[model samples]
Target: MISNIMTMVRKELIDAARDKRSVMAGLYYAIGTPLMMCGMFMLLIGQMTSPEDLNIKIENSDNAPDLVKYLSSKGITHGDSQSTNDKGDQLDVKDIRLVISDDYAAQMAKGLSAEITLIADNSNEKLQKSIRRLERNLQTYSAEMGSLRLIARGIDPRVVQPIKVNVEDEATADSKGGVILGVATMTMIYAVFISGMNLAIDTSAGERERNSLALLLSHPVSTRNIVLAKVFSVTVFAMIGLLLTLIMSKISYAFVPWQELGFTVTISTEFILLMLLIGLPIALMAASLQLFVSFMAKSFKEAQSYLTLVLIVPMMLSMAASYNIAPDTLQWLPVSGQQQALIAFIKGREIPMLQLLLSSVTTLIIAIGLTLGMEKSLKSEKIVFGL
Candidate 1:
């Protein structure tokens, strides 16, 4: 049985290699999609880091000279209160303003709140973060001022605040690596499945539609051997596509400005090895699933539709995994389990060896069951008749 499967695998590899269109389709999907996604993400990162200037308005200017000076020192220019027309048409300022009321100190002393309006172009995303930062800084400054006022009354500033707190993180480098690895793993999984779709369909349903599968099955090899060969061929193409995508991702990361993002993305040797170790079995399972679906399909178009559904499973699993849903009873679910295991590895958490073993076994069991079913179908006259 092993020798027969190996022979079939060799035949499938040769046939797949000879098919230029399948090769091209796999290359385009894996390599093209990642590059496009990376470009869009890099553009978003660029927009996030760019400096933003805002326009603001202060209502009462008389009592907030210190606040106004602070805003000016921060390079934020403010607008005058009288700039509004009778129709309430306010002249737009390029930045925010600090308004000080006559009873500002008294209002604060009584624990009453006064409102300050921030007016700026909200359309710019970068400017929004800047506005938020300014607001937080102002809040901190006000707290400090209140503390100084208490000290003047011979009260220790610490007396008013009963507790002080600080945060310490215990995350290791591997765990940090895991966060990034998770996304990459998900992306690679999607790419591999998508890239192999055409090859799997063409090898099975395409051959059936073209009236070629019947002739191939009539060869000396058993129907199971034929199915194994086709699946092996599809897996090889998928693996190649995945490897290309992995290489391209590393190359793209090298060009990205990590320092500006405040985190370095070093694709370590362990990450690459772990990705391969985890990704290989998943790819095999994907290839097997596609081949089974394609074999069950009546025509190339039908296979295409079925393959679309198959491809969606991984993406949906990935989306679910992103919500940090714990591995409960649902985690044992096929694609979901694989997603969780990959995520665990990516997060630099110690992957439960049991989960990995179980996922691999489950995928293989499903693949073997499908292969057996396909083998049975192949022996039928309806399959040979291309019905």
Candidate 2:
């Protein structure tokens, strides 16, 4: 049986390798996704991070000298549209207008409400971080003045600030980058599913349509051997794709400036090996599941449609785990459990052995069950001949 299965596996692998389209499809995803993700992260980090020296137009500087000084201390200095830096480079001056009321300083003497109007295009996405920074600083200065007025009247500032919450972070530096890790893990896991989908359909429904499956089955090999061979071949392809993705991610992620985001994401060699070890069972499950669905379909296009929809289940499971939707329940589920385990491992936390073992066992069981179902279905005339 093992000999027959190995022969069939060799045949399937050779055929898949000959199909240039399927081979390139897997390679593109393995190589392209990590690079694309890195670009997206860089763009987001740039937009979200506030500039070191925010230059905005400051109106009525004489009316509130103290306020101007406070803003300057916070890196919010005054600049016009034509302002240039010392290196002769054009300064990125935001189109923000600060209109201070003429009675600004007088209101401070009487401890009355001072009016300052900030004008700018708040709808602009590029100005969002700068605007928020300005608003935050203005609010801080206002609070300081209010506290000083209360102190003059022999009042305690603590009386107004009844609830002061001090947050003490216990998460390690590695754990703080969980969000980035989660996304990276999700992409890698999905690669296992997507990388072999086309080939799985081609081997099952495509071969059946071309009458090659009937020819292969007419030989002395048992249905069990054929099913096992197909599963092994697809799983091999999936694993190779996953390995490529991990390698690309490990190399490309090093180029990203993670320190600017206040945390680092180092895809260590240990992580790559562990990810490959854990991805094996998932690759098996993905192979068996796709083969089962492909066998159920009448044609290659139908199988493609079915697998596309069916694969969404695993995608959702991985998504839930990535974003931390239901940690308690999903921690016990299959795809999500494995992902959560990987995440915990990357976060420098101890791996949950029990959950990982249970989830892995379940995944293997699912793959075995699907393989058995495919073996049985191959015996039916209607399944083989599409009658």
Highest lDDT scorer: 2
Estimate TM-scores for all models.
0.74, 0.88
lDDT of 2: 0.90
Which 10 consecutive positions of candidate 2 have the poorest summed lDDT? 171-180
**What stretches of model 1 exceed 4 Å from their correct place?**
1-15, 18-21, 40-65, 69-138, 157-179, 259-264, 328-351, 384-386
lDDT of 1 by residue, 317-349 (tens): 766655545647536666567667766654456
Residue 56's lDDT in candidate 2:
91
TM-score computed on alpha carbons, candidate 1: 0.74
RMSD per model, one decimal: 6.3, 3.1
Tens-digit per-residue lDDT, 1-387, candidate 2: 899889888988999999987798789999999999888777766654655799998888899999999999999989887888899888888888999989988997778998999999989999898899999999989989888988989999889879987999786555556667788899999889978887899999999999999999999989999999999999999999999999999999888888777776678889989988889999999999999999999999999899989999999999988888988999888999999999988777899999998998999999999999999999999999998
Instruction: Report every candidate's CA lDDT.
Output: 0.70, 0.90
